[model samples]
Target: MSTTFPLLTATAVLPALGAVATAAVPAARREAAKWLALLVSLGTLVLAAVVLIRFDPGGARYQLTESHAWIADFGVRYELGADGIGVAMIALTALLVPFVIAAGWNDADADIEDSDAAKQRRWRPTQGFFALILMVEAMVLISFAATDVFLFYIFFEAMLIPMYFLIGGFGDRAHSGGEEDGAKQRSYAAVKFLLYNLAGGLVMLAAVIGLYVVTADQLGEGTFSLQQITEARAAGELTMGTNIERLLFLGFFLAFAIKAPLWPLHTWLPNAMGESTAPVAVLITAVVDKVGTFAMLRFCLGLFPEASAWATPVVITLALVSIIYGALLAVGQRDIKRLIAYASISHFGFIVLGVFAMTSQGQTGATLYMVFHGLSTAVLMLVAGFLISRRGSRLIADYGGVQKVAPVLAGTFLVGGLATLSLPGLAPFISEFLVLVGTFSRYPVAGIVATAGIVLAALYVLLLYQRTMTGPVEKPEIAGMPDLRARELAVVAPLIALLILLGVFPKPLTEIVNPAVEHTLSDVQKTDPEPEVEAAK
Candidate 1:
């Protein structure tokens, strides 16, 4: 087989391939459609594992590199590769896709009826759902792999379409909330998400144009490629004064912060999460949300070092407020899922805090936190889905005494909850500790406040567990509810295993991430010398 079609590049395209195959399947064979979708997801997962095994953790640049000139006039290329961070995220996306598919298996009934013909029609839309999800998987993979800034932006914006449909059409409340109610909620969320992102995109577009202009003015040539830009900036050939860098910083920061859905700009998350299905939520939170954090590391900090240094204090403050605000809101929520969704806001704040701290340990901790958060959150949401499926409610007050009937489920809830709380020996603890340690070295006050988020996390996670799993088995309806099934266990066991494994052996992952991080930080150091930069010209 040609190396060009190596596992990494092919992984992104496979889902699009699956979408095509799924579209071709006759509407009459809905069962076959489901099976085919499952197979495609599994294939991608296996391919991702292969990519991970083949990955060189020691490399400081993207490994398994693939590039092809694709919009030559605009300096765009079909570039793909992974450093340790990208590979870990790719693995996380691949790992979560199968579980997302499995979650959809017994959950797609809202679209089908009792009749065989009705089921066939149900199969059609359900297949469409699977196909859309696969497309999403492909987009996320490409977004992560794209080495050209222009290419990255294309994949970055393309993700919104599939996700908007996923939340709007496949949602449990899509219809019951009334045509106007559900439609309005989804539409509002979709439009808000799109507009906020587009606004950021516009700013970044200006920045990118400015970058190309600067490069051509200084080096006698223009290129929109990431490597080209990095090299030019590193060589002191691309120059932006302090004021210009600050504007560009805000442009990139707006896009990431909106996506990060940081404090004050985080209005879109609750509604979106409330309207989306569990699997859709997993995809949105675990995979799509990381893009915001990833872009900050890749673009803003990579390109605007002086601006990044200037804005660190302000961004760290917002991050702290997000942590506090999210935790407070989580405590007041009646909807269990929404509460977990808000909890993510708080956790993301911690990640941002670490990243902006700009210490090697801080960025590495932020990266690990990203991966661990994805794993723990996927399992938590799956378990929540299982409960909602049995009880037919997401309201915390509606649940009581579940522990007596579903001991296994209660235990699963315990594991997921404790993991979320970052209890010792859990994966999050290692990262959270590193984040605090690293951040404290720079801004002790911000680090101290961010540390308070951990306490709130424990309270909210434990409170959720107590209300849902440990109450007396009084309700006749809930008392007869079934425990976790084989399929549910199949979907979640890997996450639990990984949480434990990473908690114990984080060094292997961290060792890989630190080298690339050092290289990135070196770029920042080079840009710190504004006088020398001006002198070079």
Candidate 2:
């Protein structure tokens, strides 16, 4: 069952309009911006929930679509739709924004000692901060809902502007002592992130153009519609030759790998997340990063199945390397924010591995991992932000025996950490387990190597927890720190509850995701290789 309601367009537009509305308010009333942004985000969440309820999991195609000619001459249509995976991603984006706003409510007024120059450039967390966040939400929603390749690219690049400002503008200079040095470091991280992504985008643009040219040659006119391209490929009516197809695939894959921040290309993420505020970090690492893996499944494989299959060996190797390398680095980090960033790189490896595995279980697990990662990471970052706000530092060394003073805060942090490490009763555990089960069924060697990540995950999370939350109250400043406040609890409680709920009862999410995975695998026209067993074993 499909229907036309313009819900997707509404979800994409409301946040931008809200951003404008928040910006229009007077500076004296800047506090009102947070409330307004919250309302808008909540409304968007409701719309996304409606979409989820209305979505037919059994349907193998985009639903509740809004398609109309945008640039008729170029065959570019303003198309918006969501399949099960897209719906889940959209819902995750919507569900997280309101909490981000809430988590950052007092960020503007939070007192921190900094050099004069640092104070001058520091983000005030005023109306503009909230506005930029809302703008990002709008673009993100559009990017996930977009069915036209050009439309997706436009929204995809458009998301960077707000996120750039969110990192550079709103970030604290606590990592460095000198105002000049800290500001410079923040600027450098933001720029590195932008340059890396922009380079990838340019490469993808060339591929997009190549695809259009090939489509025109084959079908007599150019098209940037994903569905059309996919159908043409399936029907064997669009053949760009194996070489061109692989080239096009690489173009798209390169952009996604960078965004996915796969292995070596992931250098930008740690710095960016370290320099950015917690809420912004959550937005980037959790919500925005999912776009990379999602596009891998949607565009890379959907349009270039043969190339994807051919490249699986290389992709799986990178995924395994990411799993090990990211975990090792995470264990070595002193800064909590950067530690979480490395942890994310490790988790993203699992997501990518599942995507490239090309089995029904693998795709479903990857998609679910996207949602679980966002929620769990949000809890970790937000709770850590609470600790930073009280301690006026983000370094783990600065903290000791925080639990004695702030037991609730410590408990929340532990929950977040456990979820991050994929504790047996947490949401991430389910997704991670499925990813391994699926991968082992096909690529047993890679799957076995990747399991080491699970052990590494426990080490890093527990190490961080033990270093900061346990031991004697050595720091006088930390001894009197207050526990989690009402507002802080309000922000984190739902995330914790959902993690537990989904961990135990994941059937609702899995039912929605399974069909979508089946659909994606069907598009690729591949099945998992049968596992071999020894005769007497």
Candidate 3:
């Protein structure tokens, strides 16, 4: 790539530029914005791919770091860099965006003019879609690349704005008359998603400020960058005591947990899924939510290694709860989208399970799991959106025998759903296996219980497939449902290829991840040694 401008920075900024250009088009010409957004997303994907190709898997530190002063007096800098984990997430974000655009294609103009009243209803969703997507892209990029703690928190919180608008404003619906109906549901979902995130973020803000204070007081006014924090923590300048570190860790953990929507905090996701468009849901559920798992690794583990060790049992218990809980709830869902949302919650439990396991293989699996899950979720959401659009309903009963008509569509959904269940030779199977293997070495009981979640995953995914794709050819509406078109296949097929390819040939991908993961574990080991236990004398 170019020497002067880093590829990672370009990948982040290009989408914002495209969003602006798309918004400037006249109302009548706004359709151009959709294509522009698609192109920008495609470009960002290419850039991320280039980063993967050029990245040195054996490197000891962040590659292609670009740092400059942003707020000089406050010691904040416009810093960006990625290790293996960041690179993988960057690619996942890029991969999700194009499919998001494709999934929303029909919904982008859902209220278009067939009559004068309908014409008035066309309030230009393309612009809002473009803007929200670009905003998400930029925020995710920043979150991935940021080497500074303060900058990381900023990007982490900024993501909420675009996501709130995407769920609340763009795809929202109002009830015909009752309070529990249509648009009212969307409003409630949006508010719950926002309020939960904002409250968590505010708590994190306090922790971030406190981190800076401690770093300054002890380390002699060094920058609030993550790299600096690590250096100080290493040099014995920053004391990671049980009380203070646990508080700080919780501050970071609560925000990420809410974002990950782990267990109880995950209540907002099903509601949000019910109201949002498929593409927006794909981005929110697939890419943006990865931020939570990503941050758990980046901030919680990175900054408070001692606390992480101290809190492992509690986190692991919660993860187990989410695994069993999300799966049981998913099995009970009538709304297909909400079912997928709960599946994500279950998958996230596995991701956290890996991280708290605190082994190299487990963390690597968790990180890779994020990438694999991102792809599968995107595929499911896009294809599910198509299915819903044709049937004019989100209920699974509306989809009985759809396979008899839309064979290609049903086939695509089958592939995605199977991957979600971690069928052998698919991507998730490997990641989930690695996580269980790695966690088994450390937290044996947790690993054993979490393995049961895989069985639950199978039940939910297979039941979804049976309800929507198999069974009797009873419903006439299912017979009329169209099969996948070329354009639709174009959007989903790459994801399928990647999923299979990664599952079979994970060596190349794992090599890219090993170096960064090794560095992370090295830090954790350095900060927290096993405490000396009193003998039973």
**In terms of lDDT, which candidate is strongest?**
2
- Ranking of candidates on TM-score, top first: 2, 3, 1
Q: Which is superior by TM-score, 1 or 2?
A: 2
How many backbone overlaps does candidate 3 show? 4
Best by TM-score: 2
Tens digits of per-residue lDDT, candidate 1, 254-362, equal 8888787788888777777766778888888888989888888887887888899899889999999999999989988888888988998998898898888888778
Provide the lDDT at 191 for model 2: 94
Per-model TM values vs. the true structure: 0.93, 0.96, 0.94
Residue 360 Cα positional deviation in candidate 2, in Å, after optimal superposition: 1.2
Model 2 accuracy (lDDT, Cα): 0.89
Error of 3 at 263 (Å): 1.2
So what's the TM-score on candidate 1? 0.93
Candidate 2 residue lDDT tens string, 1-537:
446669899988999999999877665565687799889999999998998998888875798888899999988999877888899999999999999999988665533335666456534457788899999999999989898999999988888888888888778656646667778888998999999999999999999989889899999999999888888888878877889989999999999999988997899999999988788889899899989999998888888888998899999999999999999999999999999999999999999999988888788889999999999999999999889878878889999899988999999999999999999999999999989988998888989999999999999999999999999999988988999999989999999999999999999998888877877898879777765866775
The lDDT for every candidate, in the order shown, is 0.81, 0.89, 0.83
User: Which digits, one per residue and each the tens of the lDDT, describe model 3 over residues 416-490?
Assistant: 998999988889888999899878877778889998899999999999999889877787777777798887898
Model 3 vs truth, CA RMSD: 3.9
| Candidate closer to the true structure by lDDT (higher is better), 1 or 3 | 3
For each of the candidates, the C-alpha root-mean-square deviation to the true structure, in angstroms, is 5.0, 2.9, 3.9
